[model samples]
Target: MIIGIDLGTTNSLVAVWRDGRAEMIPNALGHHLTPSVVGLDDNGDVLVGLAARERLITHPHLTAAVFKRYMGSDRVTRLGRRDFRPEELSALVLKSLKLDAERYLGEPVEEAVITVPAYFSDAQRKATKIAGQLAGLRVERLVNEPTAAALAYGLHQSEPESRFLVFDLGGGTFDISILELFEGVMEVRASAGDNFLGGEDFTEALIDGFIDAVGRPRGLSDKAATPALYQALRKQAEQAKRALSSNQEAEMQVLHDGQTLSWQINDAAFQRLTEPLLKRLREPIERALRDARLKAIDLDQIVLAGGATRKPLVRKLVAKLFGRMPAMNINPDEVVAMGAAVMAGLKSRDESLNEVVMTDVCPYTLGVEVSEQIAPNRFQAGFFLPIIERNSVVPISREQTVNTIQDRQQALHVRVFQGESRQVKDNIFLGELTIPVPPKPAGEISVTIRFTYDVNGLLEAEMTVEDTGEKHRLVIEENPGVLTPEEIEQRLRELARLKIHPREHLPNATLLARADRLYQQTLGEERQWISSETARFQAVLETQDEERISAARQALKQLLDEVEGESWL
Candidate 1:
């Protein structure tokens, strides 16, 4: 069966089209939200999800979380004894989710539709697909995360038409998209976002506040000294931030360098600390609305997605800016996965979702750098000439004409870039094409560059030299920061040797890791209580009595849940 996966920055989830409905497949721990964390055990086995997340506090040197921030970079995380690329780390998470889906479906799944932020670069998108390949699944399509959320929300409505905005704030990225549904077609009018802004930034704001108040602890100032201590403070800050989301005031304490550091923050204080980030949330919304050529009042609905939307200030900001209360009918954490499943079903031509026809726009402006001549013997380079503007409908072709500046120029170089910047240096260079031209006087030799951008995010350029009628075509696929075909094959061979933990051990391992993390976070009686509970759970695990182990694990999970409280997601 084909599945849809939301390979998110904070958490990952898998869903499938089963029995004419989109059904979320629970992980081995019976939880739909799997933390996007990976680590290696002492025995040299890979650990993912909650088990690995716990290690962020207990074994920071050997665990990596939030690696999604480096998807297109060459940065590597050293976990345990091995060094791994960001994509490699992501592959492990995808592989773990794949195993969960296989066990849930009782079959070997082969393909999936994965979702990425609408503003992800081409290199980032390709890296994600390569990650899927590394995990033994064919990546069929990469749906925009905000668009996916809209699809899930719009598919159920019988209304003939409507225009809605999707404000998606996830762990590490934010996206704002505008979509119009008319006559069974859902067309994305525009998308804009700051890839680096999201829920994590809010937590970091709190961290900054604590650091400013307590003075930078020596261990935290130098992460290499005590990585675990730094990670613990980060974790505590996150929890306290979530508490402030519901409670007017929240208290957090971190033990660092043999000293207890404590801080108390009310909702107003947290909001003030995160005001800069909250301010950034409006630009994307305003841009999306402007790009769609509509005002906030023109929108029929404003949909919220991603776990970060659960923040009270975020909702308040949306209401204040948009002059309306944002829609929250669907669970923010689960909606994207549900929409991805529906997209997967649509890709497979599932009958239930046949009526929905969705179209997405190019997220960035695609253009080429040109030299403009305003006077004789005077020229200016770095001028951007846009062939297709950002937010234009995909599967589109546009042509722009250029004249040779020098007399009898032998060739013209077509340099391609993607961005809205007027200067070529400010945009991302995709590739270039050199078209041979018949030497002619200045302004006599002209070449037309036709850019055909497809729905699959591929850009094809055709340069036609007007003098000789010679045409050169190039399919722009080579990009910096992405592995070549040979590199991908070699990397695949290297990754095959990596051994992830067996599925059967995941539940117990996750519970044990969480309890250990709690034990480390507490002090005095609470610490002793957690210590005894962890030991008891360990003893029960040794018995290997399936029924008894299951009962104890559930009880332990409940106790921890009560103590930690419900997560914002």
Candidate 2:
């Protein structure tokens, strides 16, 4: 059976095509969403989902989440002794979801339809699929998260053909998508976003305000707080933001190092703290609408997705900008998951979803990294593969031909890039793929780089080198950070072979640890939260039957819903 997964930054969700309809398969928590956190133990093995998040307090260095932002970059995170690319870190989370689904269905599930942000770059989309593959699942297709939601909503509502916008303020990324429904196809006209901004940013803004107003323990930098405490504060800050939606004010108190720091923020103040970030929301929304040549009230319907959209500020922003209140009924958090399930149903050829067809776009521009000698001592940077824009239709391939610069250059290299950066160095280099160019006049050798975005948003670069019949294909991916291959290999071997904390006995570890324990003890409200949390944990543990593990997990997770809530009391 085909399943749908929305691999969000702050949270992840899984849904499946089942019993003549698309059904959302909640985690052990009975809730549809699961935090995407992963905790590393003494061994290289990983703990995913709620347990991983729980471990965040006791294990910050070993726990890493929000890696979706680094999807297409060359950064590598070193945990303990091992080196992990952003995708590898993400694979742990994906692997967990696969295990859960298999356990619940009592079958080995293979194919899946994964969803990405409509504004994700080509490389980022490919990385998502790679993560899925690494997690041992076959990626059947890559659908945009917003478009998936549209499919779910549009198919169910059967609204007349018109234009609309999908405002997705997810956990780690924000995507403003303009889509048009015509005939039977829902086409994404344009997409824009800041991949680095999302729900987490709101927490950060709140934290900064808390620090400034209430102040931290003497001599403790906001950075020096323990992993657990920092995690707690961020978690509370998010809760406060949510609380402010209905309540006029939310208060927070934490006693660190015998110092009582207390503060209260009203909805107005909370909005002020996040106002700077809110300013950013307008551009993407407007840009998307303009790209589609439509106004805020143009056609019909404005849908919202992602947990971040739950913020009252976000709703006000959309309502004010669009001159219309967005649609309700769908939970901002679960809608994307629902959409994912619907898309999976479509892929499975489920009759109920046959009317739902989505047309998404390329999120960014694709080009080749090129360097030309402009001066005796300086080189100028440029790129090829122009004309094609990001957020363009996927599963689409294009052939672009170019020639070599130097004569008798038998070995020519093809450097791929994504983004609108004028300088090649500013863009991401997927990898250096070489072609066997025949030794001919400088400009005579010709080669073509075929850029393909499959239905799954996976990219393939096929080089046709005419000179020596040398054809090679390369996948654009993160180069392990600043480490050499030898260093990375040695690091991975050591981390995998021996048990160690992700902090690796570094100075940062001691500082972070000291701050962590301090913060947890001071979080007084956690006492009130203990009973329910314990109950939830115990319920899941009771399902010890191997075949019942999936069911048990779901039970455990039901308690974790509203994870952002402060239990400190």
- Estimate, for each residue in 201-263, the C-alpha lDDT of model 2 and write its tens digit: 998998888888777445445744676567767766866777887899998765566676678
On the 0 to 100 scale, the lDDT of residue 238 in model 2 is 67
List runs of model 2 lying over 4 Å from the truth: 40-46, 72-89, 155-157, 216-218, 371-379, 383-387, 406-411, 439-442, 464-569
lDDT of 2: 0.70
Candidate lDDT scores, in order, read 0.86, 0.70
Where does the lowest 10-residue lDDT sum fall in candidate 1? 215-224
- For all predicted structures, in order, the TM-scores are 0.94, 0.80
- What would the TM-score be for candidate 2 when compared with the true structure? 0.80
Q: Taking the tens digit of each residue's C-alpha lDDT, what string does model 1 give over 282-335? A: 888888888999998888888999999999999999999888999999999989
* Model 1: CA > 4 A from native: 216-225, 436-440, 468-470, 523-533, 555-569
